[model samples]
Target chain A: MEDALLQAFLFAQETAEEDEGSLIDVVPGLMVWTFVTFLIVFWVLRRFAFGRIQGLIDQRRDRIREALDEADKARSEARELRDRIAQERQQAKMEREQILEDSRRQAQRQLEQGRERADADLRERLEKNREELDAENARLREQIRRDVVELTLLASEKVTGKVLDEDDQRRLIEETIEEVDVKRLASEN
Target chain B: MSPLLAAAESDFDPQHEFLLEEWIPLHLGPLDLSVNKAVVYIWLGGIATILLGIWLMRFGLSLRPDRRQTTGEAVYDLVQSQIAESSIPTKALHIWFPYVASLFLFIWVLNIIGFVPLPISNDTFDLFGVELPTLGIYAATANLSVTLALALITFFATHVEGIRYNGPTRYFKSWIPEGAPKPLLGLIVPLEVISQFMRLISLSVRLFANMLAGHMLILVMLGLIFIFSAWWLVPFSIGFGTVIYLFEVGIVVTIQAFVFALLSGIYIGGAIEPEH
Candidate 1:
């Protein structure tokens, strides 16, 4: 760089060999050089540098846009899923309550049926026991009449000294029981 | 005062720094294509701009960027987004983005080169029996001719693009306001023509004046110390000179380059799609 500068400066003494024009003076040579130099720089930069940099910038911008779009889509999908789950949970909750209500109603119906059946069974048993007791009382009454007839026969034999045959004894016992009103006597005993 | 300073004092003209000293004289009939200091600086600026752009923009660019690539992208973004995209239409961006970008960078490089003290000088001193060049500050952009040439390119390009986009009749016709009183057409037409030429003057002179003024201010400040030749003037002169120097390098150089490029874009764009 220093060498280049030195070479650019290699010339005469401090004095301008010719007088310079005013500060605003136009020089054709410098103008041409400026124009040409600018053109060269512009062309080189356009060809070699700008195209690729712009393309890369556009590429990065596109990637960012795509990423943002994907994020938005994912967010919406998550919201939808949450909504569906909430709806299903609500339906399940209603179904559960309905099942509990049905179970409770069925339990109440079964309990009523069981209590009614138990009451009917007790009534039937009580009627059966009362009939059995009446039958036993009738049977005891017959057995008492037989015992009284035998006792009457034995007393008659001991007091009068009569030895009655089978027909007479039967007749005598019959009459004696009739005269004694055995049904009433048995009732009294 | 030093002998070199004494020598400079004799030849001290603030405008001399902007003067082109013909080093290798080459004439094409009447046209002087001589290699001069301004020409050399322009060449240097153009070449450096190309190299710097390539290095920053092309060499190390990755999806995951390093510092060099990041800076390149930042510069590229600034030109593309701020200048080219804003001024040039979408249809024309492919053609003009690089153009405006190059213009900005080239002018900016030239402007900055003016402030930096380089070994390229119109004068030299003897060193070890050899005449060696001394360091001096010169900016090619400080010249009216250089800025005017740049403006001329833009001026021509604007009309060409305008004509090409909207046939010559339509493009030129758009310059005249619609439904103007036929009587006033005579006055308006000349004024419009003058205004079109004025764009060239304004564009060129704006950059030239700003760059030249910045340099002259710094030079004048330092020159005060030399003019008075007082020891006490050293602090004030150096202090003020340093301030102006910093101001020029920091703000003026960059803003001038930006304004020139921006105006070029606006003119070209307006030509293509007439605002009125």
Candidate 2:
């Protein structure tokens, strides 16, 4: 095999020499060498470089996808939180309105009760004043009658220049009072 | 002769510089296990890619990625969205991601390495007592063998993926469009097979020709100054070469890498779900 290779090489060298480098001749040996070298390169690159790179790229892609998913999750959570807060605020607002309404109703009821109590108290005071006024008028009228009777007695004594006994005077005054009463009744009728 | 003149004269040999050199020679049982500059540069590109992968992996894939991790993720994302996800079915992206990503990165690094100037002192090295240029590095993609090998891999992988997706018998049957008349089968089948083979050739040649042409243009432009050996041509050559170099490195490298990956994805996708 070695002898044959040597002979072939010798023959190629002779031809190469004769041809004087035509630039078209194909060298079988160079082709074989390039093939071997390239194959080795391809193998190395495939096994070590490309293999790892592909894995890494895939991993990076997955990580990015996961990150996007997490971001979506976070955004949803934030939206939920906002919704809950809004609901709570609405509840508080409604509660506040209810409390205010209740207080207003209570105040109105108390005002009405106070007004009713004041009205009752004012009516009672007015009735008591009327009774007092009637009593005072009756007392004044009785006193005036007594004074008139005394004056009539004094005038009679002056005219006669004498004084009457108690029984006689009483009878005379009674007669005069009866006559006055009759006249007053007729006039009223 | 002045060293500068001698150096310039030596530097202008694109044939010597672009051709494969056996930097290290070995044999393994009817196989010539020799290392050429293209292979060496390829090794460098591979090492650089491996180191970058290791550095990125050190970040350990985080949710909050750092700057380095972001950059790494961007590359992976580009491959995943632009190549794997766009090309294959959703279910199949997982299976095809690594292969597609590896191809893109490998080719990308390999294309970009052409811009890196290696330190080779013309003062020291000689080939058969003949003076040579200070540098002899070339992009592996510029080589026919390297591009052919990569395209071959794509071709086989596409067919295999097709078979895996559609059963062996159905896979071949899918080549024929549905609802086509029976008489057209005779013409279409051969054309389809031819086109399939043509894909492989075109894929290989496109990358090879683009890289090769860019490097050759730069080499030829730079070589003009040396070939003319005139002081006046120096600025023109250097200016033009710099502009071309920048254009190649900036635009060509990125476009080629993208196109290669895009085509591979499209091809694999078509095979998986044939138009018919």
Candidate 3:
């Protein structure tokens, strides 16, 4: 095993020989060019690429935030306005209903008062007409009594050339019933 | 295909003669530097770092942060608060932000390249063979060359920042605090300065060593299945490789990235600190 290991090492070293270049051969030129390229690349990247890209992304973010804030504010304001309008509409509706109710109540009271007045006027007129009818009936009864007396006087004169039948007349009047005008008085009162 | 015949036909039969000799030519004259696979990877890592850095800065910052922004900001903030602000005095830290940030990002990207499976082809003629295509890009941090270069940059940047902040005389004098024993300055200041320079070595070697060891460990572990001809060793080696690979995926990547950033911040912060 040891011999084999040594053999392998020898072969590896020999392979290194077969590979022509040493790391030493190429280092100086690599360094010079590496520095030059680094500077150029650094300058170009700084100037042309990264600066603007970062700035743009930041700007976009700012704008987006601003827009979002504005939208939120606008939405809140709209909601407030809507709420106010709703409240106002409710108030107006209530006021209108109150007014209508008040008018209706007033109209009902007026109608009740007018009905009472008309009923009172009709009752007074009816009482006055009843009193006039009673008065007229009384007057008509008196006239009829006078006409009956005249007829009795004419018959007594034809039977006996004088009016001397007083006893008979007294007897006749006592037998006749008195006419009571209570209904006619009631109408007059 | 009978089992006996198959066994006889195996390439590793004792009778078969396999040449064990292989030669790679190395001519070290005038430091011949070529853009090899590691170099390509280094470039890729560096480019990726810069692009990612720019993306983090540009796309990560927000007036109002989201998840990605928060994540990016958290990274920067973590580096800033823990490293720069804590290590360096607040007054001096701000000036080093760019340098520290750059260093942090550079190191992080280089360290992260280990996970990338780089294809290595034997093309001596391509890079050195003059006829074949070059070996392709792999993990650059796996090579000490790249990490050393990075550390050198950090070293120079730290000095530059120190000078820039305090102007040379005050900066050097700052090493000797006001009430230090007169003899101690002579001894301590030199040591402090040397140690400061030595920080670059530590930083470079730390990253280079870690990356190199981790890659080598993975390679060696995976290579074991081929090394041992016995079937029993296969499962063990594969299991070991898998565990290390998984750990590297998480711990190695995160630790390397954090350390790189932390060290960069510390370097810059130390440079600019006042004489407190």
DockQ of every candidate: 0.35, 0.30, 0.12
Candidate 2: clashing pairs of residues: A5-B30
Alpha-carbon TM-score of each model against the true structure: 0.82, 0.80, 0.54
What is candidate 3's lDDT per residue for A1-189, written digit by digit as tens? 234334433443443455443432334554565556556654554454434554655586788899899999999999999999999999999999998998898888888888887887777777777777556666655554444444544555666677646886665443331443434534544
**Superior by TM-score: candidate 1 or candidate 2:** 1
Show model 1 residue runs off by greater than 4 Å.
Answer: A1-18, A106-189, B1-8, B126-130
Top DockQ model: 1
Docking class of 2: acceptable
Model 2 CA lDDT for position B168: 83
A107-159: candidate 2 lDDT, tens digit per residue: 99999999988888888888788877666555544444454456556766777
TM-score of the second chain for every model: 0.95, 0.89, 0.73
Candidate 3 colliding pairs, count: 10
CA deviation > 4 Å runs, candidate 2: A1-23, A127-189, B1-7, B120-133
RMSD of each: 6.5, 7.7, 10.5
lDDT of 2 by residue, B20-124 (tens): 657688778787768767778778888887778767864466778888999899888988888878887765677677777878888888888877777432234
Q: After superposition, how far is residue B255 of candidate 2 from its true place, in Å?
A: 1.9
**What is candidate 1's lDDT per residue for A1-189, written digit by digit as tens?**
234223222211122233455246677877888888999998888888887677777887888888899899998999998999999899889889889888888888888888888878887888888888677667766777677778877877887689777997899778876787656765676
